[model samples]
Target: MDYERQPYRRCGRSGLLLPAVSLGLWHNFGEGKPVDSQRAILHKAFELGITHFDIADRYGPPIGAAESAFGRIFPRSLRDEVVITTKGSNPMWDGPYGKGNSRKHLLATLDRSLTRLGLDYVDIFYLHREDAGTPLEEQVATLDHMVRTGRALYAGVSNFSPEHTAEAARLLRDLGTPLLVHQPPYSLLDRRIEGSLLGVLEQEGVGCVVYSPLAQGLLTDRYLGGIPAGSRAAEGRFLTPDRVTPEVLAFVRSLAELASARGQTVAQLALAWALRDPRITSVLVGASSPEQLEANVGAVDGLEFTDEELAAIDRAAKEAGVEA
Candidate 1:
C-alpha cells in the first residue's frame, strides 16, 4: 500500500489531483464475477495510489451491477480518501425517462446512482454522452444543479465533440459550476481526440481523464498471438474477433517490439503513450484481476517517450489505418 509508488497530477485547473492511472469498473465489477475478486482489485488499485474510480449507470452487463458490487466492497470509511465518479445519459431503464440529458432524466439517474453506490455524494458526476435531443443549456444546468445541491462535488462530460464541449463548458461556467473534467476514449488506435478535443480541454482548463487507453484490450498482448478464449473479443462484448484483423495484429506486433526494446510490455507502452500528453489528467484502465491492475499502473513508470519513438508510433498507427 505504498501511495508514493504512483504519481499524482493536477486535474486541469482544478484543485483536485488525480493519479496518472485510475481504475475503471466497467467490466470486472459486474455480476457473475466473484465479489471477493472485485474487492481485491479495488483494494489493490487504491494501494497503488489509483484514487479515481470511474463507473457508469450502464457499465454492468445487465446494468447497475458494477455500482451495486462496488457498494458492497468499498468501505465507507475510505469514501473521503477516494474520488468516486459515475455517469448517466445512456439507456438504463425502460420508457421515455430511461435516458438522455433532460433535467428529469439526469437528476433521477443520479439519485439512483447514489443509492446504488451507497454514497451521499459522488466526487464527480458526468453526462455519459451528449443528448443532442436536449438543449445544451438544460444539460449543463442539470450538472450545475447536481453540484449545487450536494449530490455531486464536480461536473463533467464524456463522448462530447470539440464544439459541443466548448459550448457545454461555457454554459457550465455561466452557471458558476465550472466543468471539472471530460472523459473520452483515447489510445494509439483511436486518436480522434488529438484533432481538437484536447485543444478545447486545454483552452477551457477542463481535466481530461481518458478511458479505453488500451483500445478495449487491442493494445495489450492478449491478442498478439490470437484471441484467447474468454477474452472480450471472443465474448463479443464491445470488442469482436473481426477487429483482430491481420493488419491490426501486425501493428500490435510492431508496438510489442518497441515496448520490448524499452523494457516494457505492449500494454504499458500504450498506457504511457496516452499519458504522454500533459493535458491528460489521468488514464482510466479496466482490470479483471489485481495483477492486471498492477501491470497497467506500470505504464506510469515509462510515461516519457523520445522524439524518434513518437515518430515511430505515429508511423505504425497510420500504417494500421489509424488517422493519427
Candidate 2:
C-alpha cells in the first residue's frame, strides 16, 4: 500500500484536488464476474493513488450492474477517502423520456444512479450529453437542483460541444453553481477537445477528466502486431477492429519506440501525454483487473514529458490520424 501517491491536481479553478489518474468502470466491471474480483480492482486503485472512480448508468450490458457491483464493495468507512462520479440520462428505460437532458429525466436518473451505487450523493454528477429536445435552462437547472438539494456535490457535463458547455456554464453561474468539470474523449488518438472544448474549459475554469486516454487500448503495445483475443476492440463497439489498420499499427509502434526511449509503455506514455496539460484535471482510465488498475495508476508518477518528447508524440499521433 506504500505505492507513490504522485500528486493531486486542482480541478479547474475549483477548490477540489483530484488524483492525476482516476479509475473508470465504463467497461470491464460488469455482470458475470465475481464481486471480490471487482472489489479488488476498486481497492487496488485506491491503494495506488487513484481516488476518483467514474461510472454511468449504462455501464453494464443489461445496465446498472456496475453501480450494483460498487454498491457491494463500498463500505461506509471507505466512502470518505475517495471521490465517486457518475452520469445519468443515457436510456435505462423503454420510454422516450427515460433518457436525455430533460429535468424530469435528469432528476429521476440521478436518483436511480444513487440507489444503484448505494450512496446518498456522488462527488460529481454529469449530464452525459446535450439533449437537442430539452431546453438548456431545464437541464442546467435540474442539475443545479440536484446539487442544491444535496443529491450531488458538484455537477458536470460530458460529450458536450463548446457552445452547449458555455451556455450551461453561464446558466450554472447565474444560479450560483459553476459547472465543475467537462468529460471528453482526449487521447493520443483523439484531439477534438483541443480545438473547442479546451477553449471553453480555459475560459470557464471548468476542469476536464478525459476518457479513452489510451484510445481504448489502441495506443498500447498489444495492438501493435495484432489485436489480442478478448481485447477491447475485439470486444468491439466503441472501438472497432477497422480502427486497427497497417498505418495505425505502424504509428503505435513508432509511439512504442518513443516510449521505449523513455523506459515506459505506450499506454503509460499516452496517459501521461493527456495529463501533461494542467487543464486536464485527470485522465480517467478503465481496468479489467487489479493489475491493470495498478499499472495504469503507476503512469502518474512517470508522466513528465520534455519539450522534445512532446513534439515527437504529436508527430506520431498525427501519423495515426489523430489531430494534434
List the candidates' TM-scores in order.
Answer: 0.98, 0.96
- Cα displacement (angstroms), candidate 1, residue 131, comes to 0.8
> In model 2, what are the clashing residue pairs, if there are any?
none
TM-score quality measure for candidate 2: 0.96
- Give the per-residue lDDT of model 2 (tens digit) for 1-324: 332576788898999988888888888778987778888888788678777889998898569988888887876787887889889868889887788888888888889989988899999999887789988999989989999999999999999999999999999999998899999999877788988889999999999999999888888888877988887788885889998988778788888899889888888888888888889999988888888877777777677899998888778767766455
Which candidate's lDDT is highest? 1
lDDT of each: 0.91, 0.86
- Per residue, candidate 1 scores C-alpha lDDT tens digits across 1-324 of 467978889998999999999999998888889988998998898789888899998888679999999888998888878999999999988999999999999999999999999999999999999888999999999899999999999999999999999999999999999999999999988888999999999999999999999989999998988999998999999998898988889899999999999989999999999889999999999998999999989988888999999999888877876544
How much is 280 displaced in model 1, in angstroms? 0.5
Model 1: residues >4 Å from true position, as ranges? none
Backbone Cα, N, C clashes tallied per candidate: 0, 0
* Residue 24 of model 1, lDDT score: 93
